[model samples]
Every structure is written in structure tokens, then in C-alpha cells.
Target: MPNDSPELNHEVTAPRAGTAREWELFVSEDATESPRHVGSVTAPTREAALERAELHVGRDAATLWLCPADEVTRRTAETAALSNR
Candidate 1:
């Protein structure tokens, strides 16, 4: 682990399935108590994906787990349909 912290806003982009997206991890002092700023990640398996993302961001902070690709597609469609009204 890196003892010295770098500036925030660090991010990494890589391939996923076919499309590409950005994944980042960082520390947030504002978090309730401990450092918690594990950024977002997208992958087939949430666990593995988050792990990879955490490594990229290089900080031990809270995380927002992402759902599977199919679930995201379904939810997006549902939200689009609802907003079409």
C-alpha cells in the first residue's frame, strides 16, 4: 500500500466485455469515520470487478458495487421507458 496519498480524481479505463469504461478508487476524508471512497467499477462479476477497480484506484476506501451487465441493461431500459412519459 502507498503511504503517501496522491491528488484525488485519479481514474483508469479498460476493456469490459466489448465496451470500455472508467474505474477508479480513492479515499474520502468526509466519509463518516474511516477512509471510504472506493470508486465505481463495471464487470461481469461484481466482486472480481470491484477488486480490479480497487487495485487501479489504489486506495482502501468504501465501494459502490455494480450490478451485472444484464441487470444494468434491464434497469436502463426500464428507466428510459418510465422517463419517456
Candidate 2:
């Protein structure tokens, strides 16, 4: 059987007052295509993030996905090399 596993990284932190948290925006123009990372937004809350995303890119997207930047674990090629050591 194939291993059906989901990537897990659930750590989320609250944004401080007067500070904004980064949100990753993914949008799909149509149902046939997968959502692609378009850009990012800085907001104090999830609701604000969605609002900003909609204003900027959601108007033409069929679907939208907003992910907290803190929740994402990004690894660059250089970092990947170091991790393999």
C-alpha cells in the first residue's frame, strides 16, 4: 500500500499589537488548475489577511488559500544541503 501521509507543521503564533504577521497567498484562476503561490500579505489577523488577499488577487481567482507564514517551514537549496550533512 502507498503511504498516505499529510505534511504536519502546526505551530502558530499570535501577532503582537501594532505588528503584522505575514500570510502566504495561494490562488487558482480555475478549477482545473492547482492553486499557485502568488504573493504575501501582512496583517494582524486571519480575517484581515483574507480581506487583503481578496482585494489584491482574489477577484480573479476561483479559489484562495491563506496560510500563516509562521506555519510554513521553508527550506532553500542551501539549507537543504546543510540538513543532509
Candidate 3:
């Protein structure tokens, strides 16, 4: 009998050894506003990403969000225009 399990069907993946991961930083100035991408940082872990972000852009930010660059999708107007052709 074939075992059918959703959890078992998924493959786990991790960054390669000694590779630095890029993290995107977002900052919001106040509670009423949404966070905007300010810059990116390359680090080995989330903690290090936060420290880098704080040093660069988090000093006056009301909130900060750090997301792995690979996990975020971005498309710019220039790219969009090119794709239309």
C-alpha cells in the first residue's frame, strides 16, 4: 500500500554551507503606516540581520521587519514595462 501524507510529501531545504543569506529590511515610521523597504543586509542568521538593520535604518523607525530576500518577490515599473514588450 502506498502511504499518502501531505507532511511527508514536502521536501525540506536549507541554505548551503558558508553561504551568506540576503535579508530585506522594511521600516515603518508610525503605527498608522505600513513598513517600506529601506535596504538589504547579508547575514548568516536572523539575529545578525536585525543587528545590521538596527545599525543602518532602525534607529527612528516605529517598527521593523526583516524578511529573507529569497522569500520576497519584487517587480519594478521598468521590469514591468520590459515584460510587456
Give the best candidate by lDDT: 3
Off by over 4 Å in 2: 1-18, 78-85
Candidate 2 worst ten-residue window by lDDT? 3-12
Candidate 2: C-alpha RMSD after superposition: 11.9
Choose 1 or 2, whichever is better by lDDT: 2
Error of model 1, residue 10, in angstroms: 22
Alpha carbon RMSD to native, model 1:
11.2
Candidate 2 local lDDT, 1-85, one digit each (tens): 6555554444335554348888999999999999999988999899999999999894799999999987977777776886576
Query: Relative to the unseen true structure, what is the C-alpha lDDT of residue 25 in candidate 3, on a scale of 0 to 100?
Result: 92
Please give the distance, in angstroms, between residue 50's alpha carbon in candidate 3 and its true position after superposition.
0.8
TM-score of each: 0.31, 0.66, 0.66
Better of 1 and 2 by TM-score: 2
The C-alpha lDDT values of all candidates are 0.50, 0.84, 0.85
Ranking by lDDT: 3, 2, 1
lDDT of 1 by residue, 1-85 (tens): 6545466444333345465443434454345655443445655455667677657655544434444434333245545776676
